[model samples]
Target: MRAPRPRAILAVLGVLLLTACGTAGATDGAERATEERVVRVAAAADLKFALEEVADLVAEEHPDVRLDLTYGSSGTFVQQITNGAPFDLYLSADRGYAEQLVDAGLAAPEDLFSYAVGRLVLWTPDGSALDPAPGLTVLAPEDAGTVAIANPEHAPYGRAAVAALRAAGLEEQVRPRLVLGENVAQAAEFVRSGNAQAGVVALSLVLADPLRGHGRWVEVPVDSYPRLDQGGVVLSGAADLGAARAVREVLLGAGGTEVLERYGFSLPGS
Candidate 1:
């Protein structure tokens, strides 16, 4: 065509720009829809290893969903959730904390369910002279200077540790040499780092590889401590309730149970 007017050329360019913008908008929307759907999970430190395996299973099944796990003492998570933390799910080492969340209106009471039963173990780093035993008597040796345990005030594992010690009549003796950790994982870390001679930690932790080989452990008597009936709740403020529920279901299902059992956890109500 004969040379188009400058105005006509400018108009054509504007139309092209508008078309490009529309295409970009549609692409952006599609990308947003496909972006990984993240579900924040606040889990007890004891679930560190097992939960990770469960998360991997979840990822394999639901490629669109991503689990973001935050591990800590269940009591700490309860406080955070009660104070309005943005978590999609809360997996507590103790069922009491989950019930507390339900009672406080932070979670649906019906959504609370027991997932696993945790067991405590006396863990000593590999090559340590200390012998693993059912009771705290192993720590009586002068060389076993200090014992690490989670904080009893806020950690379920810590409370269990204290209970076990009390039942074994060693609470009085061990109390003076106790080095407290913020959570069970940290308590294990204390022993691993040689800051303590031994630690009372979750059996799940000691069963996982790397850690399993890193230390020697003995199961504490079940009667020595109260049952660790672990439970989980979907938070009332969940960003994706469906996804949260799906993850919970996966954990309660066969595949998840297999992973939990592999990590030394017992299924609840089993």
Candidate 2:
């Protein structure tokens, strides 16, 4: 075969280089475009419904970003995170637990902040079940068979329940009748499920549709316990730190704040 002219060989090489560059660029763009980020969020059980609402709202705007939420007592969630549960964010029902994560260096302390102040409520489905007039006074020590409370050892709501009972002068009376739950949501379930005649639960849970349809409740006096300052933090090992940050903004944003309020949660400023 005759050797190709220098100009012909140079032109062919140039064409090959251009084609390779185009293909590489397309591949790079495809890889970048195909990458979708997911953020795992660990939330308190009391926030199950509220967080679900916010998740739905965020999903409308961020199709590529997803929220993977796990709900439980704050203590349990914190323990999970410390054990490397791969959560990107943590929302605790109490500021103390969130601070514990910050102190343990499991979370980014700078990102730690309180979102809401939880309220405990005394709820009952039957208005006339034991009342002179439907109130906390009726579930007195002599009257309660089973009064549900979150586990005070781990659940912030449980701690509040203890405090509320103590303040109302019903602790001793209700003590023997107390039935513990793992978290505030479950505490509400005890009362709603009729496992316990009445219970102390987070106001948010009692206000949820299922509970609302099932009963009526009184907001436990704020004077009873230290404020249930619910807080959140961004985890250090999150894959999409930016997305996590976006989620924080949305949660603290007006829309999220509004949802929290309607669910009986008190906001930071309020």
Candidate 3:
């Protein structure tokens, strides 16, 4: 076979080198690509802005990790999680849902913990003629054509809103004027859009920049309603428990606490 030509030998060597280089480059690329692990989070609508801020901070330290948050009413989130929603973490605005998940064998109680103490508030758009004093009486019929609140059946914040009104002895006077929102954030929206004279919403919702620029708020007396203890847990089917745990830590960590505090949330027991 003429012992193979010299050119053929060179060609074979070139192919081998190119193949080795390509493999090396591919390996390097893979290593550099963000090892982002998707951690699906079922969060309360009230937590929309606060959680996003925490997620951004987490991304700074964990460029390879990303939080996929599904924001809605706490009860709705609980139902979805029970139905096997693709979530690695659950952050409810109230403890009831998290406790329910634990009791239902859907979440591991050992992994569950309170993340924040949800706060409620009365919010109104700029220049609105509403006074949000503690234990304030309901406005006259003509003064409050509508007062917004989330649907109590599915939103923890909504329940809190009702509780506050009841505590203030305004429920009977205000119930007929109540405008139901799908979530606390939506209740805030009802005020922001001038659809309601005033609204009860999560303090975080009104504290968030978007709403802050459009309105003013006053903290509802903490004593008026049951404590809103928000909690979270790692899902049973998490593909990356480590990532989920990291996110949980970030939410419970000092940095996370600061972020929450900045947005009107308080640390558990604080």
Candidate 4:
């Protein structure tokens, strides 16, 4: 072959250089695009705000893991989980529900993690004539308009609300005007929307952003109802058990504890 012309050689070299640079850039981009694994979670409605904050903390530490949460009543969740729902984690409002899963063979006992002890609150809209200062007895009047509470059949908070009402000797009066929500959050919404004059809901819900400044709340006496020690479990069928375990540790870690405490949940030791 004849000796290549100088300009042609330089052009060939330039094309090769450009091709190499493009390849390097592509490789770098691929390396930076880390894949995140999704963990499906079924959490109690009482954990709506706190769990969201905990999930944010989980994201910060484990960029490779992501949580997709579904919130509802713990009892209902227990039934769903028993029926083989595809949730990676089940965070219940009552730890007993988690234990039930363990007993039912749906979850291993070692996988259960206690998250927090939940509190119930009596909430009233800001300008409403009703005041929760009088405690559960505030709903005793026949003309108290309407009272909202979670259904005791499924929601832990609902059972607590009913207990508190009964303890206060107001069950008869309150039950007559009670509006049962599917979950504690929904009961708070009933109060927020003015559908009910008063609500018996999770302290966390009333303390969360949406209801924080718009309503007034009084904590229900802890002795009136069973202690709502909340807990969760990594499902036996979790797609990413490692990720599920990592998320569990995040909840037990300081950041998650702070978020839970800030939302009115009591720590196990505290």
- Estimated TM-score for each candidate: 0.95, 0.86, 0.89, 0.88
| Per-residue lDDT of model 1, residues 64-158, tens digit only | 98999999989988888888888999999999999998898888878999989999999888778888864578876566788999999999999
lDDT of 2 at 29: 100
Whole-model lDDT for model 1 versus the true structure?
Answer: 0.90
Where in model 2 is the C-alpha error above 4 Å? 1-35, 126-128, 132-134
Task: Write down the lDDT of every candidate, Cα atoms only.
Answer: 0.90, 0.84, 0.85, 0.90
Clashing pairs in 4: none
The RMSD of every model to the true structure, in order and in angstroms, is 1.6, 4.4, 3.0, 4.1
Residue 41, model 3, lDDT: 88
CA error at residue 14 for candidate 4, angstroms: 24
Give the runs in model 4 whose Cα sits over 4 Å from its true position: 1-33
Ranking by TM-score: 1, 3, 4, 2
In candidate 4, residue 2 scores what lDDT? Answer: 94
Cα lDDT of model 2 by residue, 87-193, tens digit: 89899998888888889987777889889989888887555274323456778846556888999988999998898878878888888899899988888788877
Candidate 4: 10-residue stretch with minimal lDDT: 136-145
Model 3 per-residue lDDT tens digits across residues 1-270: 569999999999999999999999999999877567999988889888988889998898787899988888889988887888888888888877888988898778787888889888887777776766632464545566688999999998899889988988788888888999988888888888899988888888887888876766678899999999888878777888899999998888888999999998888888
- Model 1 residue runs over 4 Å out of place are 141-143
